[model samples]
Target: MTRRITVAGVSKFFYLYENHSNKLKSTLTNLARLRMRKRRKFWALQDLDFTVDQGEVLGIVGRNGSGKSTLLKILSRITVPSKGRIEMFGRVNTLLEVGTGFHPELTGRENVFLNGSILGMSRSEIKSKFDEIVTFAEVEAFLDTPIKHFSSGMFVRLAFSVAAHLEPDILIVDEVLAVGDQQFQMKCLQKMEEAMSQGRTVLFVSHDMRAIRRLCKRVLFLDQGRIVHDGPQEEVIAMYLQSFEDLAHIPFPDSESRQGSGALRFENLALIGSDGVPRDEVAAGSDTILRMRYRCLSHLQNVIFSLTISSLTGQILFRCISTVELDSPFSVSKDGVVDCRFPRLNLNVGGYLVEIEASANGVLADRVREAMRLQVVKGAYYEGALPNRQSQVLVDYSWQINPDGA
Candidate 1:
C-alpha cells in the first residue's frame, strides 16, 4: 500500500495562564521571556512520528488526557502543530465534533449540503447523494424543518450521514461511533467498512474495544503526549489496558476521590482463592471469592450491593448484583461484609479493575469507581492448550473442523 499521510517529529503545546492578566503579560513578554514561557507550557502532543497507508485502518487508544484528540485535530488541519512537519498525499476529511459547522436556523436539507460542501463535496455531488443521505439519516419528514428543532439524535444522524457519504482519500473519525442508538451505531460501522473496501485510509480514535478490534489491523497507544506503543491491534490494546496494573489502590474508604451520598461507604476489599486464603493474584479458571466490607454512615433501607469486574480501561466484563426488581432487597443498618463468589473465574490472563457500589431506596448511597485492581495469572482454561495472548474474557466451547475434500 502507498503511504497516504506522514507525521514527522510533530509536537503541539499550549500556553497556560492563571488569568487574563497573566495571559496578556505572557503575550507581552513572549520573546523576551522565552525560557519562562516554556516553563508555563503544556505539551499536548510531543515528537509524534507515524504514517498511514492507503486502505489501512489504524486505531489510536489512550487515556482521556493522552493527546489523542489533539493529534486528530492537527491531522484534520483544525489546528497547526507547534513544531515539526506533516505530509499528506491525499484529501483528508475529519468526523471530529460531527456537527461542527451546523447552523441552528438552516433547514436539515440545507445543512446537509452546507456540511457536505465543507467536507469537500461539490454542490452537484451533494445533489446526487441527497436522497441517500436523508434516507440513511431517517429524517425524511423533517427535511425542510430547521435542524435546531430536531432532537439531538436526529441532528447527530444527519450530521454523521453528510460527513460519512463523502469519498475522501483519508478519513479521521474520533469517538463518533458512540453516538445515536445501537442500530445507528451499527450502520456507522458498516459505512466505515464500505469506505475501507473502497481503498480509503482510516484513522480511528475510540475507547470502544470491540469496535476497535473489528475495524483496525494495527494500533497506536499514547501516554502523556508520547507514543508508548505502536503495533498490532491486539498487542497494543492489551498492553495499554494492562498499563493500569500498578495504580496505587487505597483499600480503605477515602472521602476525597469517591462519589455518591454519604449514607454508606466501602472500607476494604479482599480477594480469596479456592484454597480459603486471600491473595493478590488470582489464577484464571479457578474458584474465587470477592469480599467487600462497608461501613454504614447512617441508617439505610432496601440497600443493594453491586460489584463489577472490568478491564483496566474501565470496560465492564462481569457484574454481580445483590438482587433485581423481582428479588428481595437487603435492609441493613450497620457495617457489614458483602461476599460475591465465583464458581470459576472465566477471565483471560490480564489486569482488571474492581468497582463496588451500594444503593439505598433506589438512590446511590456510595460508589467507588475502579477502586481496586485484580490480577489474573496463567491457568488451565482449556484441556491442553495454554494461550499466549490476553483478553478480557474466557469461555467454554469446542470447535470441529471438517475435512476439505469430504
Candidate 2:
C-alpha cells in the first residue's frame, strides 16, 4: 500500500498566559523574560509517529485536552509543529470547527468559489461541481446570502458538501459534523465512504463512537498528546475505554475527582446480573440491573437520580432518570440504594461506561463519570449473527419472503 501521510516525531507546544496582557508581554519579552515564559508553556502534542496508507480511514479519539485538534491542525498544514516533521502525498482539505475556511462576509456562493480556489481547483473545476455542492447542501435558495446568516445546520451541510465534493485527495474532519441533523450527517457519512472507496485517505476525529466505527477500520487513541493505542478500531476503542476501568472502582462521592454540590453524594455503584449476583460482564441480550447507593446529610426534596450508559467513545447509548422514569422524585433524608433495570440491554459486544448523577430540587448534587466499566460480551441478541458492524443496537425480528404468496 502507498503511504499517504507520514508523521515523524511530531510535537507541538503552546504558551499559556494568565491573560491577554500576559500573552502580549510574553510575545514581546526579551530573551530573559522568554526564559520565564517557558515555565508557563503547555505541550499540546508530544512525539507522535504514524503513517496512513492510501485509502485508509483513520479515526482519532481522545478527551478534549488530549491533543486531537492540534494533531489535525498539524496534519492539515494549518499550523507548524514545534518539532519533528510530516509528509503528505496530496492536497488536504479540512472540515474543522464551524466557520473555518469560508469567509463570513462572503455569500455562500462566493465562499464556495473561494474555498475551491484555495483548494487549488481551477475555476472551471469548481464550477463543474458547484451545482452538485449547492444541491447536496440543500441551501440553493440562500446561495446568494452571506453565510453569516446561515444557521449552524446549514453551515455544516454546505461545509461538508464542499469538503467532500472538492475532490481533495485527503480530508481531515473534526467533530463539526455533530452540528448537522441526523439525515444530513448520514448523507455526509455516505459521501465520505464513497470517497474512501475511490482511494481517498481520511483522518477522522469524533467523540461519536458510531461514526468512528463506521468510517475507520483502524484507529489511533491519543492521551496527553501521545499515541496511546494504534491498531484495529474495535480493539483500540476497547482499550481506550478500559483505561478508566482501574479508576472506576475508586471510592466515589468522597473522591476529589467528582464534581457536584455537597448536599447529596453517591456512596457506591453496583451492577447486578440476572443470576442474582454482581458482575462487570454482561451478555448483549441479558437482563441487567444498575443499583446506585447514595447518602445525604439533611432532608432533600425532589432528589433526581440518573444512570447513563455510554460507549467507549462517549456516545450516550441510554439514560435512565428517576423523575422521568418513576413519575415522582424521591424525598430522602437517609442513605439508600436506587435500582434501574434493563430487561434486555440491547448493546453490541464491547466495553461500556456506566455513569451516575443526582440532583436535588434542580441543584446538581453529585455527578460521576465512568463510575464503573461494563463489558458486553457476545450473546444471542437475535436469531442469527449480528446484523453488521454499525448495528450497535440489536433487535429480534424475522425476515419472510412471499409470505402473502405474491
lDDT of 1: 0.81
TM-score for candidate 1: 0.65
**Model 2 lDDT, full chain set:** 0.78
Which residues of candidate 2, in runs, are more than 4 Å off?
17-38, 98-101, 148-152, 253-321, 328-406
For model 2, what is the alpha-carbon lDDT of residue 180? 57
Cα-based lDDT at residue 35, candidate 1: 42
Query: How far in Å is the alpha carbon of 390 misplaced in model 2?
Result: 38
Kindly list the per-residue Cα lDDT of model 2 for residues 91-139, writing each as its tens digit: 7877675344799889999998887776567899989999999999899
Candidate 2: worst 10 consecutive residues by lDDT? 378-387
Give lDDT tens digits, candidate 1, residues 238-326. Answer: 78656543321345657566877869888777776665545456666667888887888567888888988898887888888999532
Collision count for each candidate, in order: 0, 0
Give me the displacement of residue 148 in model 1, in angstroms: 2.1
